[model samples]
Target: MDELRRALQTRIEAGTLPGAVAAVASSDGRARVDALGVTEFGGEVPMRRGTPFRITSMTKPMVAAVAMMLVEDGTLTLDAPVESWLPELAGRRVLRRLDAALADTVPAQRPILVEDLLTFRLGHGLLLGPESDYPVAAAGRALDLTLAEPFPRTPYAPDEWLRRFASLPLMYQPGARWAYSTGTLLLGVLLSRASGVPLDDLLRDRLFTPLGMTSTGFTLTPSTAAQLPAHYQAGERQDLSPPSLWTQRPPFPDGSAGLASTVDDVLAFGRFLLSAGADLLTPSSVQAMTTNHLTGPQIESAGILLDGSGWGYGMSVTVRPDDISGPGRYGWDGGYGTSWCNDPATGRVCVLLTQVSDIFWNGTMPEFLHLALRCNVPA
Candidate 1:
């Protein structure tokens, strides 16, 4: 753990990351948090434990938990057609080919199930196209969808967002391919509609309140906002507009790629999931949520960091263990440089927060993962 702390501080001093905070925990509730460096370059405000991180796609797991809450109560069923709750997705169309023109399409063979959203199998997602100017990127930009390469500042309201998103044909039939991001966003809308409340409010009531995750939310309070740092991409500072997006209400309270949280809050979430939902979910539900949902071929590209793991509801479940992390560990990383893993086998939960986009490119995140897992055991 001492060496781990020094490595993080060394990176901060060398300016690889503007700032970082991490929390590591064991199933017995023992945990340790580390914060290092200044929040901005050539600035004096040092990073602290309370600093809020733009947790990006890490929000998916929490949103997934909310959906499971509804499912546990019979408000939603796993395999049921989501059209009953989300009308905008009623009759989806699929593109004839992934790179085909917008007009080339076919009707969907089956309704997108509620399960598809949890499993990221609703087809369309941020497909890493062969080129930067891929058609999927252009189509999403055409819809003004805040896909967050630069980090989402403003967003279309949920209804308008979904309608515009639905305008693009799904890349494949429902459940045919394990797409990512879009399904989680759709789940936010579906859950909100099913519960008769906004997604933010719904999460606050069912997830944040129940778990005591007081510092987690799509928007932040003024105090919490003060602790956030500038975003970085490819080692350069990436600016976002309406700076208050973290402090106040955003145009869209995104379930897929929004939410800011502290290391404490993230560790709290890890604890809850490791505790088998700790009353927020049943043991069976937790098992199902953390279980691998992908088939043999679908496991190939769930993510870059978690390359070969099978995805579960929002996180990736390891089918085979890596060198440092073992199988049965589940969690997701964020585009805005945040990651968390809950290892049920070792009873370890590791969370790392930073402000750099594509933090994986620099190898710091993976190094941290290895160190943290190696240090999981007590001295």
Candidate 2:
């Protein structure tokens, strides 16, 4: 455990990151949890074990778990069209080409399915490379859809957000290609509408409460806001300071990237999935959610983000082992410099939390992940 702490401390001292909290648990009962460095560079607040991080896209897996629960409760079905609950998306248009104008479109080959949302096959999402700045992505930005930015969140309520989203044409036809970001956002609203509960309340009643994840939610009250570290990009502080963006619930509870959580809370989520939902979700549902749903071509289309991995429901599935992990390990990263993964082969769950977004693109995140695995896993 000290090895893990030391590794993070080394990075902190090296100016790679401000601070981090990490936790690991294995099925045979071996476990380690530790925190190192300060909340931010040169700050007096020591990073505590329970400090909350803006888990960002890590919110997807939790939301995906709740969606599976809804599937089990008969509130939703995977194969069914989502138009029943999301009538705003009943009629949809798709761009003819990745660079096509917003009005250069065709009717959707089919309605977006519940499975599409979970699997990220719902067409419109973040584009990469040359197509990234295409008209559709521009339209999404103009509408304040908050498609991919982790900070500076959407201001519209769910209904208005959905209305704006539905007004645009999908980049690809539903179920045609695996895109990123948007589907999970759609699932957030779909989950709320289908259950007739607000997204925040639904997540609380169904997932967080059941898992005893006390430190996970859409917003942190003022009293607990101190637990949130100063978020950063590069070395400068971001605007997401304490008692601000995360203190009060945003008009939109972004299912894709809008939750603050502690490392243990995320670790518990990994454990829940590793336990095959442990009574909250059926084994089959867990299987479906963790299994790769992308075709090879679709994976290729996903480009750098997939990075030769596969996407299951809301998380990335490791189809091929790499330096940091083995095949069948399933987890997701939060754009805000947090990583969570569960390796069923070793029955190990690992979580690393930090507030610097640059670490993901920089080498720090991968180094931390590799070190965490090496420190804990027996030879």
Candidate 3:
């Protein structure tokens, strides 16, 4: 564990990373937390355990957890269609081809299911097609239908954003393929409409509160806001610059990317996931969530995102043992630099938070995962 701490410190001293906060915990609640580097590149504030990280797409798991809670409570069902809640998605269309024109579409065979949203297979995504005429791609970008893929988040209020999203045709039939980001955002709306409450409030009552994760939320309270560091976007030369205004709350709390939390907050949730949802979620639901639900071309569609793992509801469930961890080790990374892993096999939980984007693919994440894995679980 000391080696892990020193290695992270070495990165900070080398100026490769601005700041990081990491923690490793076991079943009994004992934890080892290490903080390294300044809050901003050359700023005076030191990184602390309480530092609120932007935690981007990592928001999916907690938001997914909220949806599952409703599922368990009988307010929502996994395989059931979400059309009842948000009428915008009731009668959907699918493109005949990936590059097909919007008008050249077919009627959806079935409504998008709750399971489809949970599994990220509900047919819409940030396709980023270079052909600017692609209506779905054009509409997504013009309406700001995403958050923090490349940063400077989507600016639309949730209702208008949903309206714009509803106007776009599905990239594929419901449950046909796995797409990035959009299904999760839509799931946020699904949870809100089905629960008849805001997503944040549902998350607060069902997840954040029970987990004792005080610093985790879509909106930053002043106290937690103060702990937030200047977020940086990594340049080609490794120069870290503050990307955009992240200090204030956004108009819509994007379930896929809009979240701010601490290492402890992440770890607490990680531990719950390891504990198969602890008291908040059913073990069966957790089991289903951590199980690999994507198959066939879906894996191919995911490209390298799965990285030889499987997609559980909100996080990546390890399907096969890798160098750092084994099958059943589940969790995901944030678009802004933060990642967590829960190894049910070894009873280990690791939470690592930083301020760079796409930290999962970079050597930095795997390097830290190795170190954290090396730590003997706290007695």
Candidate 4:
């Protein structure tokens, strides 16, 4: 734990980041938790284990778990088309070319399956590189889909957001390739519609409550808001103030990137995954959620977003491990300075949270993750 604290403290002293909170547990029932540095670079408040963070894409795995619960209850099926629940997506169109106008398209080869959203294969998402400036991206921007970061909260409600999204053509045919972000957001709306409940309430009832992740949710209440630190970036003084967008319930409760949570809450969720759902989910369901579901060609097409990992339900599976990690380590990183992974082989669960978005790209995140992986399980 000294080594871990030293690593994080060095970064803080060097002005690389403000502060961080981390939690880890191993198969032998050993565990450790630590909080280091201040809430912000020069802020008075110190980082704490319970500090809430806007977890961005880390929300995916949790929503995926909820979907699995619905599946187990017979409310949804992996193979069934999602059109019955999200009629806006019933007749999707594919762009003839990414550069082509939105009107130039072919009908989808098949309706999108529930599994497509889980696996990010629904074919509609943020385009990367030059394709991001293509017609699809332009259409998304026109609709204010706000797929990428540095975004204000979207004003449209879930239904309207879906309607705007469905107006555009998909970049590829259904299940053709992995597209990031959009599928998970759409999945949130689908879940709400199918269950006849709002997404926030549904998630609380199904996942957060059961997992004891009381601090994890779409909106930060008065209690949790007090725990939210000021968000920061590498060069920027402040990315988001404490009482920011997260304090209010966004019109769209995006399952892809809408939740704020604490290190302990995220650790609880990771522990649940490590425990193979801890009786909340069947072993087979947990296996499906964590297993690599992408084919070789699909993985190749996903490129940098997936790097070498394979997409599972809504998280990345470590198909290709490095020196610090082994295969079957499943989890996702949040764009907003947080990461969570459960190593099934070693039975280790790790959660690292900070308010600094720069860490996600500035090498600090990778350094912390490696340290967390190597840190001894304190007896």
Candidate 5:
């Protein structure tokens, strides 16, 4: 195990990555954690066990769990139309693609439901793929959504931003297919409205406080912010410049990828899911959140495989475990180079955290997972 750790460390030292933290825990009472390289290339801080990281979309599973908790408590229904909670989504329209132009084709056959958000069928796209005209792209551009610049710090204060997002045409019919979108952010909006609390406070009161995730939250304080590792682009050794001052606005409480947390904090979250709710969630709710809810290759592509891997409320299920040659593992990755997976069949959970962008599911992540699995075996 130490040899594998050394190999990972050596890789980072040899420039395969900037720095990383990896941990593995199993139901059989075996665990291993290792930190490699420097937290910042030019800083003196060594990557440590409790280093905070911008977890990005890795926040999805936790947020999904919270939404499911609301469902279990009868505060919300998965099948309920989201527009019922926020009338802004009512009478929404879908876009019919036209060459060099967009046409507002028709009203949706049905209202967008809470389940759609969980399934990524809410018509917003992540804007990186070929299908760039998805609602999130249009909405982000229309509202000038940029996270690099600091904006109003209060939640839901960016009403004009959300209004623009609500007005954009959907990329596809609700529940017709799946696309990784801002559905999680929409879920955050719904959660705040339903719970009558700001998104950050709800996360703290509901999940973080109970799970002992003290280092986790949406907005970073100056002290915590200073501990944050600089984010780097893949293959680039230099830190990426901060976004323009004008683009620094906090657009909305994005449930998908807005939170920052530590590897240990997330390990507790993974264990909670694996144990089927230790304190913050119910067993049934956890099961429902991890169960596959989408069918067919509704949103399959080279980059995002939506069919072979099952998607639950906000998780990616291991449907054909053989397809990926992994056990009955279920979890998701963040766009900003963080990933966690729990293999129920093997009773093991592995987490990797870094500040490098676009490294999820790429060579860096796969290599780390390979080492973790190798280290999990008994001598």
Candidate 6:
């Protein structure tokens, strides 16, 4: 374990990453944690256990948990049409792909439900693919959305972004397939509307306070902001531009990809879901949240291949028993190189945190996680 930590530290020192923090824990009372490198390249501050990093889409699972809490409270239903709560989504339409242009085509076969967002079955895209001729390309052009670059300086406000989103045509019919869209952001909005509270406050009251995750939130304090590592691209320091669709403030606590957290704080969250301590959810709710809800292969191409490995409500389930050799191994990753997985079968969980994008799909982080899982299993 020490040797692996040293190797990881070497990679940080060699500029392979700005810095990183990792943790491994098991129900048998074995654990290891390490913080390596600097929060920013060429900066003197050493990464610590509490150093905050932008967790990006890692925010999804937390949002999903909160939504499920609402589900348990009877404030929301997984199968209820979202338009009942937010009328803006009423009269939704799909887009038509012509030879060279996009057109508003037809009303969806059905209205989008709250469950659709949890399973990512709503007619939306990640705004990066050309597979479906949804007006994503056009919307991206109109909205100036680009993945290769940082968010635009003068971005759209949250309400404005929602208005624009409501105006755009969906890529497919609701609940037809899994598409990785900004559904979580919509979920956040729905949460606020349903709970009659701000998104951040609701999350803090519902999940963070109970779980003791004090360091996790949508915005960082000025004190904590200094400790946040700068985002990077291709091993170089990158500018931290304002988001294109929302500011890091109230009225826009984006539940989709806006939040910062530290290793320890998130680990507490992992422990809660893994049921290492008092469980926040009933076993049936947990099972429902982690089970694959998508009916077919439509979700597989969108990266919700949870059943094959499996997918629960907001987390990804390990469909292949060999993937982690567990009965209930499930978790998710963020775009900013942060990932976590829990194996209920072995009573083990591993987390890797970084600020680089595209880490889970193609980076050493996933490989390191697999190695740690293999090594930490009790023989």
* Regions of model 6 farther than 4 Å from truth: 28-30, 98-102, 130-134, 144-159, 241-250, 276-279, 303-308, 321-328, 376-379
**What C-alpha lDDT does candidate 3 achieve relative to the native structure?**
0.79
lDDT of 1 by residue, 82-164 (tens): 88878878888888887877778899999999999999888877777553445665778767786534254445788888788
- Compared with the true structure, the alpha-carbon lDDT of candidate 1 equals 0.82
Each prediction's Cα lDDT score? 0.82, 0.86, 0.79, 0.85, 0.72, 0.71
Candidate 2, residues 1-379: lDDT per residue as tens digits? Answer: 6666777778888987878888888766567877888887788888888888888999998899999999998999999999989999998988888788889999999999999999999887888654355988778888988997856778899999999998999888899899898988999999999999999999999999988999999888776776688888877788744556667778999999988888778878888898888989999999988999999899887889989899999999988889887888888998878889888887888898988989878787787777766666442
Model 6 poorest 10 in a row by lDDT: 145-154
Model 5 misplaced regions, further than 4 Å:
28-30, 98-103, 127-139, 146-158, 237-251, 299-307, 322-327, 377-379
RMSD per model, one decimal: 2.0, 1.9, 2.5, 1.6, 3.7, 3.6
Superior candidate under TM-score, 1 versus 2: 2
Those runs of model 2 whose alpha carbons end farther than 4 Å from true positions after fitting are 129-132, 240-242, 377-379
Write out the backbone clash pairs for model 5. Answer: 149-248, 149-249, 150-248
User: Worst ten-residue run, lDDT, model 4?
Assistant: 237-246
Model 3 Cα displacement at 127 (Å)? 2.3
- lDDT measured at residue 203 in model 2 versus the true structure, 0 to 100: 96
Q: Runs in model 1 with CA error above 4 Å?
A: 130-136, 148-150, 301-306, 376-379
Residue 344 of model 2, lDDT score: 86
lDDT of candidate 5 at residue 204, scale 0 to 100: 87
Which scores greater on lDDT, model 1 or model 2? Answer: 2
Q: Which of the predicted structures, 1 or 6, would earn the higher lDDT when compared with the native?
A: 1
Compare the candidates by lDDT and give the number of the best one: 2
Measured with C-alpha atoms, the lDDT of residue 265 in candidate 2 is 83
Rank by lDDT, highest first. 2, 4, 1, 3, 5, 6
TM of each candidate vs. truth: 0.95, 0.96, 0.93, 0.96, 0.88, 0.87
| Candidate 2 local lDDT, residue 359 | 83
Worst 10 residues of 2 by lDDT: 370-379
Lowest-lDDT window of 10 residues in candidate 3? Answer: 235-244
